[model samples]
Target: MTKTQKPLVEDDQVAQYAAEGYFVLEKVIGAEDLELLRGAAQFSIDRLDAAMDAAGVDRIGINAKGKRYFSNMVYQQRPELRRFIFGPIMEQICRRVLGENAFLFWEQYVIKAGDPDTTFAWHQDSGYVHENHTPYLTCWIALDDVTEENGSVYLLPYSRSGIKSYIKHIPIETGDQVCYFGSDPGLPVIVPAGSIVCFSSTVIHRSGANLTDKLRRVYLLQYSPEVIMNGDGTAPHGSYEAFLIDGKVATAVS
Candidate 1:
């Protein structure tokens, strides 16, 4: 990198993540990259809508029509998404937060539908896994200018959450696994489009509904030091794809 160009993820931001459990990289994604991600996000939403229509159901697992949508594992089909996924911006953030070796644990396009309004339950990302594992990293990228009203995520830091470790979550009828029922309200993060919120998997977080007129679109990338397998070792819970190894991007990410 040239003298004028700085690292995508700064050392101070990494320090903030260590202290607060999350850090926001504001307006880091470039215009062209943001456009590509926006297009890809729209495509995933459309596909999910069509799938729900064909299935004659508004809900597919945790994805609810006009409320919430989660289109995951698209890189396996949409090659373009891989460009943004493996780009230097993401790789650098993962390298600092998750250490030298980082495996693709999970990826998804999460949309909070507008009008009707939705409220996600407070829970830790690691709570979803049945087995005990080390805390991973979650990179929540905003595809639109996000605010508290536009379905931005609310984070509870380690100090406020008082959760020393991952706890079992109760699965609600809406398919949300809830861990906290307190009235803390959490910290609302507002940022412009193309910002990234790098947080730990053990952090307790949730998002409110999109009270605005448009859908709140976000892309999520998760990484871990090792392959995350199911509790019984039956199968990988998310993915075991090698992306980063020994503090460098993998030569061939397949």
Candidate 2:
């Protein structure tokens, strides 16, 4: 909590979240925390690259070597990331949006290489679940300036996308699970580094190729008011760790 930090959420943004299913928290990350995130992202990327090399494969699941990598639970590895994860800004955002005791759902680094091939498919965060599950909140934090040409995100609200609820996605050979195939040309998100673009888990969104010469670095964090369960009631869908209780960040991290 620096003096420069603005009010975490606004009335209009909350209203917009209810209506449009998404909102942007502009430049909310402090400079020091932003650098920590960048460092952690690079650290995770290097580790992923090493794992891929050891396995002797250029591609692992959806992670393409030198193209795109999805590194999960990155905060668990870096102490700085742990501080940022349990810090005030994220707690406030989760409390405001979820409106209940918030649980850590999933956190990851989605790093797209410079000028890679066609990237993420048009899909909802819930679409990945592909089964009945509670919709959670996704906070996509930009580690670098994001723009249309540089493979920033594009979102289609539930009202516009027409696929309002969670739907099963079709798997492709390219490793994308796609749900929406229409040509509506989703709304492009253009924002500077340190901004967080928050959206509902059911909101349809995707990103295109990074045509620029720089990597498009995004760290995504998801939170839910309740601990979501996996399909068939097997187990919790996420880490099921309590981040906030009674609208306050838990003193002891689980």
Candidate 3:
């Protein structure tokens, strides 16, 4: 019943992730497990759209001059998500890539489709965390097979070493703008279903368009040291605020 009693990480995974900033675990979730998580993601997506509509959240514009963000803390609002989030597969991987002391930051569905370039801009995870520490990892789980044809995530080789110079906001339109972590052309990361990949928050990364007929469904679970604090406990800029699954409001890590 103690922390050390929990399962430990494999040496290979730890070594690989440390050197490359990522490691892919194949078939981490079986079909049943994948289905459960997918169901929650689908339902959450629907409920989110509805909630936004009811709030008169314009499909394109902001309601109060503030930007929009989405994240689900499965341990709270979506217990079903716990099956995927804290599964032995993820727990061990996180404990290895991050440390055993790591905990959730937030989770998001980076759903994308064809022709709508709205691909995530290149940016490091730490750019949002604004923290000066380790364990700020982004675990990307693919719900379906990912391939270059449909816009898999792209990573700039060893970009984490240049974290500060790469994380910057650039204007995409007149006045309206967004952020990019780096400008270097990146290599696309394609993995099979049920596999997971981990990256440091400071690693430059982004996704491409979903050009194929299939939807590029991805679950982004971000985590960091459970005890780390970022400025009076507020969400890092560019990340979504989340609520716990039990309907309790989530506070910042601080």
Candidate 4:
């Protein structure tokens, strides 16, 4: 698929994101690109399984029932996946939400099989990382049609304020420094395949158990400004190297 030539994000959408802490873009990815992404995700899953077998260890996030939670996906090795990660339309949205020069901080592939107990606890993405950098943006791309039955993510609208103090560290299979905030603040986000839901890293969000027989797949990508630098001039523990997009740093415009 061809890249979008013009900016996909509008002024009203930016206003909505700032006010609600989240916004949805329907059909942001076309059919062709969506298929390509799905293929890349499958490739990543296969690679993960192979790597685990070679190391003689079970996958860190995979369960015996076939559920999977993989991070730092195929964007590094697959050219097709990198196109969507650094695509023009996504860059436009990131620039509008983050800054003129936002960079790709991290990416992950989250999949929930047809398991009734698969759920992600309520937590903020910012809580999983250092507190020094400004809150970043998380763009969740739905690779499958997401609904309440398939474990769609639930997010709190306008919940960024007073959220930091509520963060509490919790142990999970994903990481030792994982955190949680116990509260159902918002409704589930239901969108179709190829839809993109962008929200603040500080916003409290979680996914429910997958009750449907189909799998729920989502590509969770993050973008941050150059302000992520620490006071001691070092990157945060979970923060990845930023890929400069528009040759400008994040400014205080929003």
User: lDDT of each prediction vs. the true structure?
Assistant: 0.86, 0.86, 0.59, 0.72
* Model 3 superposed RMSD (Cα): 6.8
lDDT of 1 by residue, 1-254 (tens): 57898887888988877777888899999999898888877778888889999999998888887778899997777877778788788788878888889888998999887855477889999988874787889999999999888787999988898775788899999899999999999999999999999998889999988899888889999998888888888888888887788887883533
Candidate 1 residue 120 C-alpha distance from true site, Å: 1.0
- TM per model? 0.94, 0.94, 0.73, 0.82
The segments of candidate 1 whose C-alpha lies over 4 angstroms from its true place after superposition are 251-254
> Which sections of candidate 2 miss by over 4 Å?
1-6, 251-254
Ten-residue stretch with the least lDDT total in model 1: 245-254
Off by over 4 Å in 4: 1-7, 55-65, 159-166, 172-185, 227-254
In order of TM-score, best first, we have: 1, 2, 4, 3
| Pairs with backbone N, CA or C atoms under 3 Å apart (clashes), candidate 4 | none
lDDT per residue (tens digit) for residues 1-254 in model 2? 56886668988998898888999988989899899889988887898899899999988888888989899988777756777777778888887898858888899999998756748898889977747777899999999999888898999986797665788789888788888889898999999999999999989999988888888899988988888888878899867888888866674633
Per-residue CA lDDT of model 3 for 1-254, tens digit only, reads: 25667444457767756665666666667889888767766655565566677877634321111222233553466666766665566556655565545566777765555544545666666655444444467788888899877778887646344443335445443222345533566777778988777776666677666677655677888866544466556544323333232323243321
Q: Decide which is better by lDDT, 1 or 4.
A: 1
What does candidate 4's lDDT look like per residue over 24-59, in tens digits?
Answer: 998889988899778877666677677777777764
Cα displacement (angstroms), candidate 1, residue 76, comes to 1.5
Steric clashes per prediction: 0, 0, 9, 0
| Model 3 spans with C-alpha error above 4 angstroms | 1-12, 55-71, 131-135, 159-183, 233-254
